[model samples]
Target: GRISEGSGEDPYLGSAIAKAMVKGYQGKDLKNEFTMMATVKHLALYGAVEAGRDYNSVDMSKVKMYNQYLPPYQAAVDAGVGSAMTSFNDIDGIPATGNKWLITDLLRKQWGFKGFVVSDYTSVNEMTAHGLGDLQAVSAQAINAGLDMDMVGEGFLTTLKKSVQEGKVTEEAITIACRRILTAKHQLGLFDDPYKYSDTSRPKKDILTAENRAAARKIATQSFVLLKNENNVLPLKKDAKIALVGPLANDKNNMLGTWAPTGDPQLSIPVLEGLKNVAPKAKITYAKGANITNDPELASRANVFGLRVDIDKRSPDAMIAEALRNSKDADVIVAVVGEASEFAGEAASRTEISIPQSQKKLINALAETGKPVVLVLFSGRPLTIAEEFNLPINILQVWNPGVEAGNAIADVLFGDYNPSGKLTASWPRNVGQIPIYHSMKNTGRPAPAHQFEKFKSNYLDSELSPLFPFGYGLSYTTFEYSAIAVDKKKIAQDEVINISFTVKNTGDHDGEEVVQLYLKDEVRSITPPKRQLKGFKKIFLKKGESQRVTIPLSANDLKFYNSELKFVAEPGKFIVFVGGNSNAEMS
Candidate 1:
């Protein structure tokens, strides 16, 4: 439900991930005891916070909100999501928890969302901080705006009844909200037992079983991306001498990632253990090259709630010396370094989004050892890895890959599995390109796609593009795309366009590829994106095998909200792109 936080900013990825989660939780029946209700989160533009800070103000045009941030929420509702959580940010000029236009007009009436809505933790009371009103007024306003439950605020429990008595809120509104909550409880069979989910024996029977761990491992493997693998430095030999250096190499905790305060990190497997299990013949040695960071103020802020960031008793120089000493006898060095899991989660935003200076120095020293450096980078969001990219190193972008992190990583490192996970969000080269993505509109006098132009919509210090574009990932194996063919160059509303292409696995290993389809309304009444992802297929092929894939596009795919807010499609020339990623080449 908290989808807006972390790296899930892309609408397509958010929808797909939310759909799978909803089905996994509720399926077709909500009454089953094993099933749980899924909540789609932080409704209406909570992700595009000011300066990427959580719970900050979000201001944008209605059209941008409609086309960009609203689809994922709509997708969740369409997938039969059981609930929605209101955001802490303001919608237009009013808080979403008390905005009738957002929760009522747009969500319920226009989109026909049947589920009840809940406020973010303590958001109902916090609306007073947003200068809305006091507790009583905000609670009544939230109810009038169609919110059903007040989470952690207790504003509704204390003031809503009185507000109803005073006619500030209608009795009918309160009754309807209660009825929705009671109805959801009935659907979940909660009214029948009220204690079904709290069974005392379930923990021993279901928590972190071997079957669940296997699924976690598989899922984590699919979420990692190979950012760089120059000359195939990865797929290290089974008998190679590997030096694993970094503060996180031996950590038993922090692998569950952020916001899991109740998670039992004792049950999790660390990277050293996972590597030993998967590659028994390999000799692996580890050293704590650096802490999460060296700056005392930053470390103090990040390590408040847990032991995630462990500042060493030794100085930075001694730590790097130890790491270099260990790397000298190894065939290759693996530096498992990045921000601690606590650094990038909700309510914790950094002005500097990069590897910490202490760890960066350690990485440079490791590189100076002349050993092939493999950066097993872990982050909860995209960090500025430009400086590391300049150095000679191979990078594996692992976003704190869950409980079975080490085993899944070993699977890719030992060639038991090939990396296919694509980026759900774009990686910024620097903080200056913080909000960059693939679906931006073309400007007048647009800069050259490859280089900068003077007096254009370009930056002086960097290219107006991302370091790694959206939907970008790499695999141990290679894939080739043949020329694409379309059934017709132009089609009316009554006709569908059929596009076909072939993908061949040209390398010697079997792997999966995420084939993407992007469509652009080349000419429109209002300016549109250069391209938008319309369809994708994840296909697995054996070495030297080729598969012909077909995707169909209809009029509905091109429809957008016009100036009048009417959903309509303008007929004109269209450009279709099909390839391995968002930077797909059009045929």
Candidate 2:
């Protein structure tokens, strides 16, 4: 569930996205009226909690942390994020809220982060539960750790003054923390005018305008991933008779997604409304095929924030029967099915990452109708969809798209837009492959690409492959890669080399493609990953058009943290792979 909040499973991608987010949030200056300070939160491997559970202990070697988990935080710091929030979990046997090394040495000293540090909601007090200390001791420890602010709990507000009198925490440290907090407020112009950001006119002038919604609609279209398009069932004719069924098909509340607590759900468009708006000439029918989940306990947990998982009073069988009856006469069936918005967000973790059983039954019954089924899957995390993928149907992953959910769905359904988005995280075939990713290091007894070999690094029951690999996506149009070339096979450490390739639009649609490049070091001081994503470029092409794309490789791209924790590029034979996705074949 925590995966929903993070950029999917690769450090490089995570780093890039982190920098972009900081830039988007802070803009060119913090005092700018249109810009807001960005806070990089849950610092230090919160996403790597044990068994993907929230607030669980995290234990890892420095090497793993530096190479895999720490880059994004460093990138955010480099991008000048205004604040950092401590994670709930402990790091190296010390709670991150009170870990001096993490807050001062690594983040402030090593990374040169100028931002003030804040604790997660009540995290400073929660340290008592973590067996750290009582309110006063933990609060003192946190401030000594360089944390400038305490969120909720009020431990600092109530206990710090007494601690200072007792000499448990120095007056100077408290003064320093105060200075950092005041500096940030000054930077945001909060000191100049306390209500500067909350002007009454700001709502009407800046919030929820048509231009914002249009941009949201366009962005929503770009993010939809075409996971499967069996027998070219997608790009459906606008005039075709359609049956839209499932819990999320017409849910306005879930359209704004999980993180938007302040977003007005009523204003968000639903898929049913969107279909009519985009395809007014098409004959469309709608039915609630299934509840988000049939289990009352799960439904209750999912509805903690509100009525996200509304279980119908009707029996599961009755719900499926109604759906099948409605879809029977339609030319095609579009099933908007997956987790409710609350199923995968903060404090929400799932042992079973497949589609809910209730929705699975609805999908299975829809498949029996013999109409071409298109699964408009709504999920916050990559799901185990091997069963659905094998069925004769098309699948489009529309991950709980915000406000423009319905209009964006309609746009892609009628081929007004072709899906160019790719998966950043690998979709596991099953929960057993929880930690699968593209850059996994090669095992000593590596399994073959196909077929599982005994005594090899292969699963006994499942194939050694993800249900959907990282960087994998399908477009309505096909793209073919050829004529791969490198300007220089070898270059000095300071030199940059250009790798070029030809991409042709082999299918009959003008569409976009993200051309990705991966690199593998044949030999290095330490074990190297099978392949790591080095660079990418997004390009558009018309049918039968071909374009040459070039991406540069520099010394920084080749460097990695060795056993000594030094970043260095070892001299070796390196192989480069370029294609549509991470699973691209070597040239």
Candidate 3:
């Protein structure tokens, strides 16, 4: 399944999906000997990769770490996920695989996570590259950091015993880790039947059932974010002459996106198939305008490493001309473009995050046709699309939805469903201004207001901001936010604060709105971010109907790590903002 299958980019969404998937995989009776173990992955600061590159190092204040990245993982633990996977990147100058504060103090002690931690693929060995130490030293460090099992890396099996003998590691730690692994095995009923998940008959009968495919289609539709829908170009008419032009238009393999362990690309449905399923009578013309990627380096590596696709032999310019010729008289053009399956997964990080030149050329050619263009983007990480945002084309960000991706994309395009997905990571204007997020600490020398002097912290060439802020997404219908009322304008310490808002579906069509509630510390021992996402609610409403969404702010929600690195909520005034996205602030 696609990573999107687990959640729709919200921590609350992730928590809900985690509970459902855990319950679906492992029955309500977890004690049953035949239940499966679901593992929540890349525990901390893993989603906000610098420039959307996977496995990149993460640098953030301790307070930012606890406030933003830790919530979903903590929610996963609270959901009772059977296992937790450590991240590949470093947190606060220490590799997450070997960070004692991250693995033990924060995750285990503070969060009360009872599950064992598994190292990301060979992450224990990669610790040496992260400047931690040698293999033996990093292995010992990771074990001591509360990591239990080593996935595919023999770092633990190879050096742990010797480190124990040399007093670098304690025998008790080894016993605890080994016993945790044994306990997991026992929990999965592997002791009763070691090959429970290995049932060959189960794969044929249960892996991709009709009901599962239906669920996949529904989930995929919900995960799509309608980035641009100018003049209502979407909810496309079924009888129109549609030209589906691009390499991925009929690609079965590329539909599954990235990190789909059990997804069979060969059996996956393509966008063309999905369009046909929804608009069977529509006059559709298909053209493979360009490959998912045209870079030689990416093309060569993609085939050798990840989900390989047949490379186009002709030049990209020639292919674009052919596609342009095919779309000369079409009523509308649907351009399917973006990263390939391998371009966004682990070790597939890119320094530059824009559509390849070849695909851009194809889009430019299609744009000249004077036909309304609908652009569908399939990628795992967020892309910097400043140039394309204001184009004459409608855009949708579909993050590598799983097996029934084609069908889901078609469903949204033909008005069979509405898109509700929102971004989980920030989209920067350029790669240079990366490591940008909605929640960032205030430095001593902050950027001066309306000043570009040398002493101030302002950028000379570009704006020090993100192109698309977090918690940002557009629905087919518009919604209005008002009635920003708070229960208490002033509160004492340890008292709960309640914030309420009125959200109405003001447009013609029904839609879902994510009501975001942010809090800012007026005065504290240590300065907090400009604002922090304290609470959010995803609500669905019918056209012309209004709903009241209430968010509770607990004492813990306002707490932050002070100068001495202690979590505490200072007694002070806090600015409460209830709005749509990160930039939508109120007091």
Per-prediction TM-score: 0.97, 0.99, 0.88
What does candidate 2's lDDT look like per residue over 216-291, in tens digits?
A: 9999999999999988998999999999999999898888778778878898899999999999999998999999
| 2 against 3, candidate with superior lDDT | 2
RMSD to the native, candidate 3?
3.5
- Give a tens-digit lDDT track for model 1, residues 510-577: 99999999987878888888788888999999999999999899888778888777888787888889
Error of 1 at 410 (Å): 1.0
Q: Supply the global lDDT for candidate 1.
A: 0.86
After superposition on all C-alphas, the RMSD of every candidate to the true structure, in Å, is: 1.6, 1.0, 3.5
Model 3, residue 305: distance off in Å is: 5.2
Cα-based lDDT for every prediction: 0.86, 0.92, 0.79
User: How many residue pairs clash per model?
Assistant: 0, 0, 0
